[model samples]
Target chain A: MTEPAEPHAHQHESLPVAARVRRLEERVIAAGLTTDAEIDELLTRFYADAAPVNGARIVARAWTDEEYRDRLLADGSAAAAELGFGPQTSGFQLRAVANTPGRHNVIVCTLCSCYPLSLLGPSPSWYRSLAYRSQAVREPRAVLAGFGLDLPATTRIDVWDSTSEIRYLVVPVRPAGTDGLRPDELAALVTRNGLIGTAAV
Target chain B: MKFPPGSRVRARTTDPGHHTRLPRYLRGHTGEVVAVATPEPLPDDVARGVPEPRVEPVYAVRFHGADLWGCETGGHRHG
Candidate 1:
């Protein structure tokens, strides 16, 4: 017989996840447990210091400058910090894997969701899903295909399994046809998925 | 100490009752060490919320598709 329906299936359906988070933040602030200014400071810092936009910019800079790319590849922590990433304070080391003409790279944490929060912002729900964690390792090609990235079967696919000790960022090869774009403009083309190796830059 | 890049090693198939950083799928699988990341505390110990400082170097291990899955297309490798 089929198992009974979950008891909390519709209990919290009235409020979306974002709404719930907002409401909780508001209640916590109103309760005087945390000062509003302090909370605002944390929120502001999160948006500015830890976001995909920063990751995109880093990727873009590397695409344009060979020296910078070398530095980033050699010492991601220092290179990222030079750009004001300053994310290493959280104890998670950031490792960068560059995609080449013959190889592609992807990142996942199968056991637990380990992501560079201060560098790439919070992990997306889909990135942490059990399906992604399992399939990305078992059948990476198919998993990437599901994400709309169909790398040539001949191109090598490298999947980095992150742990709490370290997280990775994929540096996708620069696409053709944007020879005249400035660094900032090039960054606009880099999406979070590109940095995660699930999509092309 | 770090594993030299290109070193071939098999992930240990250990399941301590405590915590662990190695995922199950990777345990016992053979892969080539791609890069040596800076060392840090054992993730398992970190996950257990212990303040211990015991550490190990993290390595980027690249596994060939053929080594991971029996039904594979290209001989592409994944890290």
Candidate 2:
């Protein structure tokens, strides 16, 4: 067998992240640690259970219930647990930031991609990209504009950096004309980008 | 928590050349404590695998963009 490439060369491999993950899974399965079916089952359950919809559910409840909104604002993990979304197993505390008529909120991890994955599922590739991580904090308005979110000039923007063991979830303002909608319908309107603070609900 | 909410505090300046949760850009900069997170083991120690790591409160500090990058707008929340 040919010797493996050096670390520098290996880092430059053109394989996509999914391909690399599949290769790792193959190695693990070959070593008798786990079966491919078992891994697939786990992934299926994870995607089904822990997704952006979970966050949408929470936001829907908050929009309909003022008390619940207060609780979510005060203690996000506890409020999420009330709705069957378990606290993050990573021990990262979840903090919810609400957007208002005068202010908007956005989240980024300038150091690394530390997101509230249990609530928002996998982060978008741009969330972890160096360009975003650096620019989100430096030129937030420009970045938001790129996402098609152009807030009024008077609206203040709060950019949150996931620098510690605290993960943040942006609670976008409930859309107008949705007062007659049911909770589930409201939840359906909440998008992953809205929860990430890159877009409006 | 050592610093209560709304209190202005400066991130301590240090470059120990080790793993730490505190971002480098925040060092030597002052910000207001917006919230206090539950006490947890110091990440610097946790990364180093120190036995019996010391626990401490993690404050969510809000640094204005003008102070952080000399920009004329925005507020940055850093924990």
Candidate 3:
């Protein structure tokens, strides 16, 4: 008779939490602990329900109303509550930092991606890319340039380094010549770079 | 307490982390929160080990073109 296989003996090695988790997951898969289909199904359901809709609406509203826009810049949470959004997920806090003609703003996550999910919605794929993550802090001007955002020689660009505790989003000035457009229409003009303060309205 | 709308608030500079909406340039400086925008759910990865249902509201803040560029000329300055 073959000797009984040791149960999870291979997982006892001393490793970092992240590495350990990855290794254990591999073993579990080898042992058929859970089906891939089940995992995928759970993820699908989780994300489907978890997408940030309320934040998207707030961003949309800001595009339309000048008064509301002013309020959001002052107190992000209160203004969000006024719009009927809140009471979920670590309680919300809103902070708005503006980008001006002479000074530009850029945001980044040094440790990981922490974004303003409420206002800008989910971070774009580029935000998660290593190129963006690394370059954002090292040479922000170059990174912004890659995005086609050009600032005057006299303008100074300020880079905000994001850590594990805080996430930043840029509030680009409302584009010029969009005075009469509807909110939804205006939102369309708000690009990812604009929200990050790399691009102007 | 109720605060007037469009009042500028300075974010505390002590806190540091991944998802801060407050920019470094504005930490000590003050700016008005332009709008009370929308609420957003916290990212699951960050929300872990802290509290359940982490969500934050989004605000639109405006800093004067002058305030940010006061050191340089030709930029808008606060009156």
True contacts kept of each: 0.33, 0.72, 0.00
lDDT tens digits by residue: candidate 1, B4-61: 9988988888877886766666678888887777777776777788888578777777
Could you give candidate 2's per-residue lDDT for residues A6-40 as a string of tens digits?
22222213548668887998999999999989998
TM-score (chain B only), all candidates: 0.77, 0.92, 0.56
DockQ winner: 2
Regarding TM-score, does 1 or 2 come out ahead? Answer: 2
| lDDT by candidate, in order shown | 0.75, 0.85, 0.56
For each of the candidates, give the backbone clash count: 5, 0, 45
| RMSD, one per candidate, in order | 6.4, 6.7, 12.6
Candidate 3 lands at a TM-score of 0.54
Q: For the second chain of model 3, what is the TM-score against the true structure's chain B?
A: 0.56
Query: Which 10-residue span in candidate 1 chain B carries the lowest summed lDDT?
Result: B70-79
Return the lDDT, model 1, position A46. Answer: 71
In model 3, where do residues sit more than 4 Å from their true spots? Answer: A1-42, A49-56, A87-92, A117-122, B1-79
Residue-pair clash count for candidate 1: 5
Q: Using Cα atoms with residue i matched to residue i, what is each candidate's TM-score against the true structure?
A: 0.81, 0.87, 0.54
Q: Model 2 TM-score? A: 0.87
Best by lDDT: 2
* Candidate 1: segments with Cα more than 4 A from true spot: A1-37, A88-90, B49-51, B73-79
Residue A49, model 3: lDDT of 41
